[model samples]
Target: MRLHLRLILTVLLAGFAALVAAGPAAAHVVPSTVLQLDVHEDDITVEMTLPTTDLVTASGIDVPVDGTVPAAAAEQLAAYVEEHFDVTIAAASDATSATGTWNVDVGDVATAEVEQWGTGAFDAVTATATLTPPAGADLRSFTLDYDAILHQVVTADVFVLLRSDSSTGEVEQTRSLGAITLDTVTGTVSPLTVDLAGGSARQGFTGMLLLGISHIAEGTDHQLFLLTLLLPAPLLAASLAGDRAGRSRHWREVAPTRRAVRRITTTTIAFTIGHSLTLALGALGLPVPQQPVEAAIAVSILIAAAHAVRPLFPGREPLIAALFGLVHGMAFSTTLSEMELSGTQLVLSLLGFNLGIELMQLVVVLLVLPPLIVLARTPAYRPLRTTAAVVTAVAAVGWLLDRVGVPTPLSTAADSLGSVSPWIAATLWIAAALVLLGTRGRRSGIRRVVSA
Candidate 1:
C-alpha cells in the first residue's frame, strides 16, 4: 500500500511540474485587424488597419496625435517605421520596386496616405497607396515586405491577426517575421529572411509529421484524456466476476494490456482522422465557424474523461472515442487552418501534420504502458486506478467549466501538464526497471519457499 501510494505521489508530482512548465507556451488568441493588398500592372496597392494596442505592444512607440512629440522623437519614430516596414513589387523578367518604402517614385505614385482613427476599442491606423508601374514592367508577383511592430520599439513582437485576398475572400498566406534588428541611431530596418514558401511534397510530409507530433506533445487536453483512459486498465481483472477456471483463461490474463493498448490506439487514430478531415476541409476554403468548434472540443474532452470512470458506453469505448474524436479533430484543424496554404500545399500539410500527431501519440503510449501493465498485476491496483480516475474526472470538470465560459485553476493546471513529459518518461523508465528486478526476486523467493 505504501509503495503504491509513493508511486502515485511521484506520478502526480511529476505531472504537476510538467503543467507548470507548459502553461505559458500554449498559443494565445488575440483580437483581429485587416490587411488588404491589391496588385495591378504598373505597381501594387497596399492597405491595412492595425490595432493601436497591438502596434504599441509590437513596436514600443506610442504615437499620439494629441500628445507632444519633440522634433528628435518624431524623426526617431519616422526612422523606425522606415526601417521596419517594407513593400516590394517582384515583376516578370527580374524587375522589382520597393513600394512600401517612403520614397519609391514609380511614375505618378499618387494618392498615398496613412491615417489613424478612433481612441477606444475599435481604434486602428491605416496605410494606403497607389503606384504607377514603370513602363514595360511585369506585375505577376508582388512581394510585400512588412513587420508592422518591429521598427519603432526594439523589444516588440509582431503577430498577424488577419490577412485576406481582395478578389476571392480567401485568407492569404502570412509568415511570421522572425527576430528582426533595427539600427538604434539611424532607425534603418534590416528584415531577416524566414522563407514562407510552401515546400515540396517530401518537405511538406516531414513538416507535417513534426507538426502532428508537436501538437500531441503540447496538447494538455489530449494527454489528460489518454491518461484517464489508461487509469482503469490495471484493475480490469479485479473488476470482473469469474470462476477459478475463468480467472486462469489466457484472455483474462492479457485482457488489460490488450484493452489498454486498443483504447489508446483507437482514441489516437480517431482523433487523427477527425482532425485530418476538418483540417483538409477548413484549409480548402470551407467555412468553419471557429468558436463553436473549439467549445465543442472542450466539451468532448469532458465527456471522455467522465466516461473513463463510469463507462459511459461500456463495450463500445472505441465508438465513443471516435465520436468525441470528431470534435477534437475540429479543434486540431484550427492550427492548420491558420497556416493559409494553397490547394496542393494544403493537402500535403494535412497529411504531414496528421502523421506527426500519430507519431507523438505512439511515443507517449509506449512510455506509459510498461508501468501500467506491471502495476495492474499488483494487489493495490484497484485503489490506484480509482484514485487516478477521480483526479482525472475532476480535472476534466475544471476544463469543461473553463471552456464553457468560467475559467478556473483546474483547467489552467491541466493545460500546463505537457511540460513534464521528459521527466515523466525518465521516472517511469526507472520504475519499470526496478519493478522487473523486484518481480524476479519475488519469483526466486517463492521457489525457495516451495523447495524448503
Candidate 2:
C-alpha cells in the first residue's frame, strides 16, 4: 500500500509536469476573419472593412489617425497606408492588357488622399473596378489579387468580400486571402492555388490525419479521459497480497502500462477511423442527425469514465476504447462538415488537416509517456490513484448530465482544467520527486535498524 501510494503520486506529478510545459500553443485559434465575396457576369467587386482592434493586435498599426500624434508621426502613418493599400487585377490572356496586370486606375494614389471616414472606428474602404473581357476571353475564371494590407503587415489576414446585385436579390461570396507567397525583398505577391474546392483523395486523407491529431491534442476531454484511466494504475499493483500480490502484481503491474499504451493507441486509431468514416459519410452527402451524435459522444465519455474507476469489463479496455472512440470520432466530423470541400481541394484539405492532428498527438504522447511509466513503479501509488480516478469519474458524470440536457458546475470545472494544466503539472513533479526521495530515505533507515 505504501509503495503503491508513492507510485500514484509519481505518475500524477509527471502527468501534471508535462501539462504545464505544453505552453500557450494549446489555446490559440486559427487566424480567421470574415470576408463576404460577390461575383457578377461583367466584373467582380471586393469591399474590405478592417477592424481597428484586430489590426492593432495582429499588426502594430494603430488606425484612425490619432490627432494627438506629431506632424511627423501622422505623415509616417499616411505614407505607410499609401505604400501598403494596393489592388492588382491580372488578365487571363496577355493579349487583353499591355502588361497583363491592371492596377485600379486611381492615378497618383497618395497618402494625403487616404482620408479618415469616421471617428474612432475602423471604417469601410471600398475600391471598385470594371473590366471588359477580351473578344475570346473567359469571364468565369480570372485572377484578382489585393495586397492592400499584406505588404507592411504580413501577419495580418485580409478577407475579401464580394456582393452582386441584379434584377433579383443580392448574392454574396467570401474567401480568405489564400497562400500569398510573398517575395520579402521585392514585395511581390506570388499566386498559389487555394484549395477551397477541396483537393484529391490523397489530399483529403492527409488533411483528415492532421485534423484527427490536432483534435486529440486540443481535446481537453480526451486528455482528461486518458489521465483518469491512468490515475489508478500504480495503486492497483500494491493492493494484492504477498506472492499473490506479486503474481497479481506482475499482471496488474504490467496491465496498466500495457493497457494504457494499447488503450491510447487503440482509442486514437479507432477515433480516427470512426471519425473518418463519419466525415466521409457526412461529406459524401449522408444525412446524419447532429444532436444525437453530440449526445452520443457525451454518453460514451461517461461510460469510459465509469469503466475506468472499476473495470466494467476486465481485460477488455481496448475494445471499450475502440467503441467509445467511434463516438468521439463522429463528434470530430463536425468541423470537417463545415469546411465544404469539393473535388480535389476537399481531398487535400482532409489530408492536410489529418496530418496536422497526427503530428500533435505524437508529440503529446511522447511528452507524457515517460513519467507515467516511472511513477507506476513507486509505493505511494494507490491512494492518489483512487483519488484521481474518483475525481475523473465525477467529472465524467457531470459531462454526461450536461450532455443529457442538465447544466452543472461539474462540467464547467472539468472544462476549466486545461487553464491550470501548467500549475498542476509543476506541483505534481515537485511532490512526486519529494515523495520518491523520502521513500528512499525511509527504506535506507529501515535497513540500518534491521542490521543493528
Candidate 3:
C-alpha cells in the first residue's frame, strides 16, 4: 500500500510540475472566444466575442478595438468569420460523413473591452450573425464547424454557449455546449458537437418551470420577505404585536390552526397574484428600470421584516403582500423578458415559469409554516420568533444597502444563507419535536401528581 501511495504521489507531483511549467506558455497560445447562440422562432442568431488581438493575428490585418472596428477592417473580419463559421449535419444511418448547408448573414462588428477570466480589459469584437437552417432541419443537433481563429492560430479555444432557445425554455443563463479548438497532436481544428438533449416544446416548458422553481429557491429577498411576514402568523396580535390590538378579539392568545392556515393561504395567493400580473406585463414588453426594481425588492423585504417585528400591518398581511408582490413581479419579469420570447412561445414560457415558481413557493411555505405554528403553542416560541425576525431585518438592511450600490459582507453572507435552508428546516423540525415532547411529559407528570 505504501509503495502504491508513493507512486501515486510521485505521478501527481510530476503532473503538477508539468502544469506549472506550461501555464505561462498556455496563456499565450490563444485567447478564447465566447459564442452565444439563441435559437429563435424561425432562425438562429449567434453573438460572438472574439479577442481583437487574436482577430488581427488571424486576419493579418489591423483590427481596431478603440471604438468600432475601422470600416475596411470590419468588413474583412465579417467576411472571414462568415466564410469560416458554419453548422453541419450529424451523420445518420451508416453515413461516413456529415453533410449539410446553412445560410449565414454576417453583421457588423463593434469593439469593446471584456473582463472575462481576468483577461484585464482586453479589446474584443462583437458580432451578431443569423443562421437559417434548411427546410425541416433540426436546429438542436448539429456540428458547429467554427474555424474563425483556430485555422490561423491553431491553438485558439472557442467556447460555444447557448443563451436561450425559446422553443425549449432555455434562457437567460450561459450554458456551455462544448469547446472548439485545434488538436495539438492531430494539427486539426475539431468541430464542436452541439446536441441540446431532447429538444422539444415540452422540454422548453419544463425548463421554464425548473427555472421558476430555482428562482424562488435562490432569491433571498423574496424568500425572506414572505417568511418574515409569516413569522408572527400564529400569535395573537395584541400578545406579540406592540400596537396591533383589537384586530381579532382573542387577545393574549395564539391563533387557531384554521386562522393561521387562512392567513398563510391568503397572503401567498395575494403575493402570487401581485407578481403574476407584473411578470406578464414585463414579459409582454412593459418598460422596467432594473436598478430601481432591485432596490424596491430590498426595500419591500425591509418593510416586511419591520412588520414582522412590530404590528405594522396587523390583519392586512395579504394586502401588504399584494402591493409588494407587484414590485417582485417586475423583478421576476426581468428574467422572462431577457429570453426575448415572442407570441405563443412567450405565453407558454410564462405559464410554465410561473407555475414552477408557485410550486417552489408552496414548498417553502409548507416546510417552514408547520414548525412555526407548532412552536407558537410553546412558551419558548415568542422569543425565538422575535430573534428570527430581528436577524431577517438585519439581512434585509444589508440587502437594501447592497442593492443601492453599497458593498457589504452582510449581503454576501445573507445570500449564502439560502444554500443552508434545508438544514434550517431540519433544525426547526427538531426543535418543534422537542418542544412537543416536553409539553407532553409535563402534562403526564401533572396527571400523576394529582392521582397520587
Taking the tens digit of each residue's C-alpha lDDT, what string does model 3 give over 1-452? 23323433344344323432332111223347998998877778998899888888887878765876678877887899998887776543114332357688888688887766554557788898988867666666667888888888875789988898888777767788888888889888877777764667688889899999989998877888888878878866674355465443322468999999899999999999999999999999999999889889888887877776666777898999999999999999988886778887888899999999899999999999998898788666655666666667777777788888997766766676565567667767777777678778999999999999
Using TM-score as the measure, the top candidate is: 3
Candidate 2 residue-wise lDDT, 1-452, digit = tens? 46545554565455544543443223323332233443333443333344444444434644453334345534543454435443333433445443333333222211211222122223322222343334444444445454545545555555443333211112222224443435777767654321122223554464355456656656777666555544433323333555552333322454456655765666556555655666666655666677676667666656655554554554455566567656655566565554444565555555555566557656655555545555556544435545566656666677777777898766766565555555544545655576678778999999999999
- Stretches of candidate 1 off by over 4 Å are 10-86, 90-199, 234-271
Best by lDDT: 3
Instruction: Estimate the TM-score of every prediction.
Output: 0.64, 0.51, 0.79
lDDT of 2: 0.50
How far residue 243's Cα lies from its native spot in candidate 1, in Å, is 17
Error of 3 at 131 (Å): 2.7
